[model samples]
Target: MNVRSQIKDYIAAQPEPKQKDLQELHGLILGIMPDCKLWFLDGKDESGRVVSNPNIGYGVQVIKYADGKNKDFYQIGMSANTTGISIYIMGIKDKKYLAEKFGKKIGQASVTGYCIKFRTLKNIDVGVLEDAMRYGIEQTRV
Candidate 1:
């Protein structure tokens, strides 16, 4: 019904270890951004097709496009995927910064342009993840 409820439902729907990981991540994100605006995306497009996994979002960032368009989106987002979980740090201008800075330090996670993906929380360094998330939030600040 609401963003918080949708996020809880999404986490609860996960299976086993994933569920636990999602719960932990949810708590961790909130601890990092205590007063952030929460968001929930059902992974559906305008037509309601399941285009992606459900995402739990934190904070707010305004994205300005090259075509003079802009929209508000989450600064950080987490989603459960088939193989693992994805933590997205949106609004980073430099696409290669994430991989170059935290790719090796983040343990077994894959650090892409704006996403850190790993099979489980246990497989990655939580501290490094936190640092990356903090950097992302700072970079996207309005």
Candidate 2:
């Protein structure tokens, strides 16, 4: 199916409050980047074993590997995990920036190099999250 359809199916398959949160986040991200490209990754390998949670991605960023190959990828990604949800802001250079800048301000979320993880949306400050995402988008823009 198409990326939007896949994203809908993935979000619909999530359990309980997480489903609601995912929907809200989907809309929120869209509001942030209204014309961004959508992406969905089933998180599987060639063997089809479940490797990671399915991802709903937004925007585009080109990744350059050490082997000199380049690939297009999402600038921001979201997924439901066992304990919570993970929001990945993929193009930041400083590993400590998120944690140092938004960690304390983002409520209960864990701010890592390029990810903001939290148990639920209500437990975190959504505005700071938005700021981080905006920063990521700006940083990734070519």
Candidate 3:
């Protein structure tokens, strides 16, 4: 049905401890961006094929603006990979700016115009991360 329900169902199917970790992670993310509405992308590989493996992870989405203008003005999403968890700011351009500000404090950064990857949640400064999320949400500009 809804994206939140889809994510919850997906997580619910997992085994105990992994499911618990995912629930905690979900709570942490929701707490950080309380206004964001959830969406799912069902990510594809670099080849643009929908990944069939659950272990490859799924995409988390947030509709950044709701002026009833653009359909998907901005999307903030994340994916957990073998390397680390990634925070995607769909159309914002503050990755390098943010990384420069917190790279040393967090960890090494891999950046593009609007995508950032940190090896672990522990590596990021949650306050700064929250600010980044706000920036992403604002970038949609309704």
Candidate lDDT values, in order: 0.94, 0.93, 0.58
> Tens-digit lDDT track for model 2 on 1-142?
8988999999999998999999999999999999999999999988999888889899999988999999999999999999989999998999999899999999999888999999999999999999999999999885
Better-scoring candidate (TM-score), 1 or 2: 1
Q: Residue 125: error of model 3 in Å?
A: 2.5
Clashing pairs in 1: none
Off by over 4 Å in 1: none
User: What would the TM-scores of all predictions be?
Assistant: 0.97, 0.96, 0.61
Pairs clashing in candidate 3? none
Residues 73-126 of candidate 3: C-alpha lDDT, one tens digit per residue: 335666555565566666655546655654555445575566667665555565
Better of 1 and 2 by lDDT: 1
Error of 2 at 107 (Å): 0.2
Using TM-score, rank the candidates from best to worst. Answer: 1, 2, 3
